[model samples]
Target: MLVSAAMLLTLGGCVTMSGDYNVTAVDANGQPIKMVMTSHGSAIYSSRNAFCSNFPKATVTIRDFHTGEELKSESPYHCR
Candidate 1:
């Protein structure tokens, strides 16, 4: 039992999971302005809130982390 626990602990540290949806808000120059790794569109969804409302014109791009493809075309996040 002790050996099993130790082996599990050692391997657990090496295991990792990648998110299906990765979103980031970028400025006109394509510089990163914000990030949301947990779910799709969360970054754009929160743009109306206090934290993201500051960048009214930032472009939010959602991408497939496994494929490196844009889930959709970059769109401007309007605070209004």
Candidate 2:
């Protein structure tokens, strides 16, 4: 049973996307909020002016390591 559980845990970890990268959203007050996103592969580390509120929105960009192009991005909502 222990071995099975361990195997399940390992498999779960493998199925999960890379969580090493993250994006943050700031509100009008400049408060930080965490975002959940799968890596889409982009070179941009950050994007601004994404928010439509009084404050600007920021996104953490990722790129495919091999192609050096956009992979994915995480945009945390602000004033929502």
Best-fitting candidate, measured by TM-score?
Answer: 1
Q: How many clashes in candidate 2?
A: 11
lDDT of 2 by residue, 1-80 (tens): 99999999988764333433333345555654454333322312223233333344432344444464543433333333
Pairs that clash in candidate 1? none
* TM-score of each model, paired residue for residue: 0.43, 0.25
Instruction: List, residue by residue over 12-69, the lDDT tens digit for candidate 1.
Output: 7772334465656765555776545435444434432432465555566556667877
lDDT of each: 0.54, 0.41
Estimate the overall C-alpha local distance difference test score of candidate 2. Answer: 0.41
Error of 2 at 60 (Å): 7.9
Stretches of model 1 off by over 4 angstroms after superposition: 1-19, 28-30, 34-36, 40-52, 73-80
Task: Name the regions of candidate 2 deviating beyond 4 angstroms.
Answer: 15-24, 31-80
